[model samples]
Target chain A: MSRRPPVGVLAMAGVAIGVLGLPLVGLLQRTPWSSLGATLGEAATLEALRVSAVVSLAAAAVSVMLGLPLAWVLARLPFRGRALVRAVVLLPMVLPPVVGGIALFFALGRRGLIGRALQNGFGVDTLIGTTAGAVIAAAFVAMPFFVITAEAGLRQLDPRLESAAATLGAGRWTVLRRITLPLLAPSLAAGATLSWARALGEFGATITFAGNHPGRTRTLPLAIAQANEAGQPEAAIAMSVLLIAVSLVVLVGLRHRWLAPRRRWPEPSQEIPSP
Target chain B: MSIHAEIQATVGGFAIRAAFDAPAGTCTAVVGPNGAGKTTLIHALAGLVALERGKIVLAGQVVDDPARRRRVPPERRPIALHSQHNLLFPHLSVADNVAFGPRCSGLAARAARRRAEEWLEKVGLAEAAGLRPAQLSGGQAQRAGLARAAACQPEVLLLDESLAALDAETRTDVRHLLADLSATRVLITHDPVEARLLADQLLVMETGEIVQAGAPEEVAANPRTPWTAGLLGVNLLSGRAAGTEVALDCGLALTTATPMTGPVLVAFSPAAVTLSTAEPHTSARNTWEAEVGRVQPEGDRVKVFLGPPAPCRVWVTPQAVGELGLEAGSRCWASLKATELTVRQA
Candidate 1:
C-alpha cells in the first residue's frame, strides 16, 4: 500500500522497460515517414494486407471456437492424463515458429503422412501451400495462447455459480450459455485478440508451411520479409511500424477496458470479499 | 408435497447411508454435527450425487432407484437448495438472477421478471432487485438467494445451512423470515434452536446415519446420543431401566414417570434441577448429594457445575446463589421431580 519503490525493483523495472521499448523506438526512428502512404497503397503491400487480415481473423475465430470447450474441459473436469493433455496443448506456444511450421508441413503437406492418405483414399488435396494452409499454420502457433488464457480465466471462476444455476432448473447447456460464458466473456475476448495479434505477425510458420505467394498465402509479415530481402528497406520499416501500431492499439485498448476491474462503486464490502 | 428418500453413497473413504420420510406439507429439520453427511444427503435428494443403492420417492413419484438404474439429473429434479453464501450470478442484476429459473422453464421474459419482482417483495428486497449482488449487504444478498430459489415454486425446498453464515442479529432476522415460509421444506442445520423454531419434525444424524427422528420436543426431551445431548444442552445419563426406575452408570438411580425396560437413556434439562444446601426432605422422586465444582454467572442466573454422580449442571438465579453463598467446594443436594426425567429405550 505504500508508494515507496525499492532501488533494486526500480532498476529491474528500468531494464524491463528498456527491453520492451527499445526495439519499437529503433523501428520508428528508421521508418520512411513521407513515403509511408504510397508504400502502403502499393499493389503487393495491399494484397499482403488483405490476406493477413483474412488469415489472422480466420485463425482467431478457429482459436476461440475450438479453445473455449477445450479450456472448459481443462479447467473444470477431472480426468486421468489431464496434465499430459494440457502439456501437449501448450507445446506449440513454446515451440519455435519455424519448427512448428515444419511439423505442420509434414503432417499436412502433399505426399506427407496423412496428406498422402487423404490424396489416395478420399481424393482430397493437401492443405499445404494454400491460404487455408496459412490459416492453419497461424492457428497452430496461436491456439495455445488462447487456450491457456481462457483456461486460467475459467479456473478463477466460482464453480458454485454453475451449481446454483443447475439447482434453479437450468440444465447443463443453459447454465453454460447463461452463466459460464457471460462470466468468461472478457477473458475470451482478450485471448482471441492476443491470438489474432500473434497470427498477424506470424512469419516463419506461414512461409514454411503455406509457401508465401503474391496473391494467395503472402501475408503482411511475409511481404515485409520479401521487401527486406529485395533491398527495399524503407518499405519493410514502414510495415514494421504499422504492425507495432496495430499491436499496441489492440493490446492496450482491450487491457484498459475488459481486463481492469471497474471502480465505480465506493463500497468495498460488496464484492463478496472473496470468501 | 412429501419427500421419501433412501440415499446411499460413498465419497472418498467416507460412507453415508440415510433414509427419511417427510409428510405432506411438513417442515423437517435435519440437525447434525459437521461431517455428519447433512450436505451429502441434501445433494443426493437434489440429484446432484448418485446413489449406490436406494430409492427416492417424491410426491409418490420415483425420482431415484439404484436397482432400476434410473437417475435424474439435478436440473430435472423438482427441488431447490438455498445456501447462506447466496452464490448469486455476479454478471447479472439481482432481478435477473431471481428470474433465471423461470426463464429457464420457458416463461416469457416479462412474466419471469414479474415473478422475480413478486418474490423479491416477499423477501423484502424489492428495492435492491435492480442492483447487482455485490451491491447488497450480506443479509440482503441472502434474501435474494432465497427469492431466486423460491421463484420457481419447486415441490420441495432444501435449505443447506442458509442462515448459518450471518452474524447473530442478521441470523435472527433471516430465521424469522424462514419461519414465515409455508413450503414443504427440509432444513439442514447444526443449531438446535433454529431446528426447534422452524421444523415440525426433527431428524438427527450422527456419522452419516439418522441416529434419532421424532417430533422436535420429543427428540429434545429424549436425546439418546451424546452429540444430541450436547447440542440440546441437557444432562444425559445412560443406564439400565426396570419399570419406572433407572439404575444409572454413575452409581445413582433416577425415577421417571414413564415406564421403560432394559437399556435406557435418561434426559433432563439443567433448569429442572434445584440446588439445596441442606438435605431435602421434600416429596421429590430423586435427590443427589453433590459438591459445587464451579459457580459461574450466566446473565441473570448462575450455572453451577457439580461433581459427578453423573456430570450434572444446574442453573439457579443469582439471588438464590448469593442467598446460599454457593461456590466451589460448597456441598449441596440436587433434587428433581420424577416427571422431569425423560426415559427412552435405547
Candidate 2:
C-alpha cells in the first residue's frame, strides 16, 4: 500500500519478472547437467541442430531482404491504401502461430495457390517435405518481425535526406543504398536477430506445412516435440535449452555488441537530441 | 548556376506562391516570419515539392512545369540543401557523411572521400573527420553539414534553416561561414539580421505570399506595406503629396529630401529623428509638436509614439527618456533632419 508500490506498477513488475523470467530460469536449471555432451554428439541431435542453424539463418536473411522493399513502401510512401497495407503486413504479428501455419499450407502446399502455378510454369513441386520447406515456414512467422522493425526505422528517418541526395544528382537506387540502408543498420540488425529467434523455435507452422521429416524439414523444435511425445522429456528439455541458447547468443550479440556500441557513445549531441 | 522560377504550390492546408530570378553567384535571402512558406518556396524550386502551376527554369533547363508536363525530380536537379537538423548520418563519421553526397552523385567512392576531406578541411572540420556527428560540437556539426552540402558542388544551394538549429554561439560562427560561401544560395530564415548579412537581396513574405522584396537598403529606406515597414524598421507614411512636403491630417508636415510633387510614399526611421519638449529656436529643418502617446522600451532605447498635435514617432535612449522625464500623455516636440527623410512616389 506504499505510494512507491502502485498496484499497476507492482502487477507489471510481477508479470515481467515472474512469468517471463521463470521459464528462462527453469530451462537453464534443467539443461541436462550430466549428459549434455552425449546428447549433443548423437547424429540425429546434431543433424537437427545443424538444420536449425542453417534454416533459421537462411530464413532471417530472406526476411530481411524481402521485408526491406515492403517496409520502405509502408514507411516512406504516402499512397492511398497505405494504412490498409500496413495492417495487412502486420497480420502475421498478431495471428496465432498455428493459424499462420494453416494459411501458409493453403498458399504453398502441393494443392495450394502458389504450388499449382509454380508446378505448371516451371515443372517444379513444392519442397514441402524438404529442408527448404522448413526455411519457408520459419520465414513466414518471422518475416513480420523484420518488416516491422525495418518499417519503424524507416519511419523515424527524414525523407529529406533522400530528397537532398536527389537534388545532388543521385538516382533513387543510389539514395536508397547509400542513404536509407546505412541509416537503417541498427534496426536491420535487431530485426534480423528477432526473425532468427522466431525461425529457430518455429514448431506449429513447420509441422503443419513443411511436414516434419528428419534431415529435411524437421528442425530443432520438431525434434523437441517428437522427443517429448516419445516419453523423452529430458531430451526435449535439452533440445529446448539448445534452441534458447542459440537465441540468447544471437540476440544479445546483435543488440549489445553489434548494433548498440556506436550509438551509446556520446558525441555530437546538439541543442536538441533527436525527438 | 542561375535559376528563374515562378511556381505556385499548394500542399495540405498551405499554399506557396513565389517568383524570383536568382542569378548565378548571388545569394538571395527569402526572409519571413514563421509559417510564411519560405521553406516551401525552396522545396518547390529544388523540385522537392511539385508545383500546382508555373515553371522552374534552372540554368535554362525547365526543371518543373505542370503545364508543360515537365517535372524533374529533386535528385536530377543541380541543387543541394543543408537540412535544418543537419541530418548527419548518425552511423557515419564526419568524413563519411560529407562523402555520401558526392558518392551518391556518382563520383567514385575514393574520389568522393577525397573531395569530402578537402571540403571538411575547407569548413575547418578536417581534424574531426573520424568523429561521428554525436561527437562533434554543434558548431562542428553545422560546419560538417555545410561541408557535406558543398561536397556535392551544387550549382544552387538551398539552406533550409541550416544554422537556425545551432546554439547562439554556433549560429554566430555559421552565419559568418555562410556569408563567405559563394554559391547560388537561397536562405529561408526568420532572422532579419541573417537576411541582411548573407543575401544580396531580401524577399519578405507573410501568410505564404510575398509582401515586399528588394535590396535590403531599398526595403529599409522605403517599404510599401505595413508588414515590409515593420520588417525593414521604418515608419511608412502614405499620403497625397502636393509639394516638397506632405501634411498629415494630424497637422504635422513630413518633409522629404527630394521634393515629392504628387501622391507619394514617405518613410523615416525613428532613430533618425531628434526629440525635445520645447519649441526649437534654431532651424532644425523639420520640427513637429505632438503628444507622446506611448513610450516603448526597445533594448537600451525607447520608441515614443506621438499621437497629436501631429502623429509622429521619435526614438531616444532610456537615459534620454528619464532626462526628459517623458511619459505617455506628456506633451513633446520631435524633429527629423531634412537629409534623413526619404521619399518615393507610390
* lDDT (tens digit, per residue) of candidate 1 on A119-156: 88888787877788999999999988899989999998
lDDT tens digits, residue span B1-346, model 1: 8899988987767788998899877889998888998888888898877899999998988889989988888788888878656899988999999999899888999999999999888767777777877788776787789889889888888888877656666577667767777668998988888888889999998899999999888888878788888787788889999999899999898889988889988888889998888989988999989888989886687889888787777889998888888889988899999988878788
Question: Which lDDT tens digits does candidate 2 get at residues A1-275?
Answer: 54576789888999989988898898778788699777867898888988888899999999988998889888867899888887887887788778888888888787898988877887778868878888888898899999998988888888777776676667888777878888788888888888888888888888887888888877888999999999988888888887777777886777673555564566444442221
**Cα lDDT of model 2 by residue, B171-277, tens digit:** 67667777776678988876667777788888887788887878888777777776677666677776767767787545567766677676776778878878787
Candidate 2 chain B: worst-modelled 10 consecutive residues by lDDT: B248-257
Clashing pairs in 2: A166-B74, A166-B75, A167-B74, A267-B134, A267-B135, A268-B134, A268-B135, B291-B308
lDDT of each: 0.86, 0.80
Query: In model 2, what lDDT does residue B246 have?
Result: 82
Best by TM-score: 1
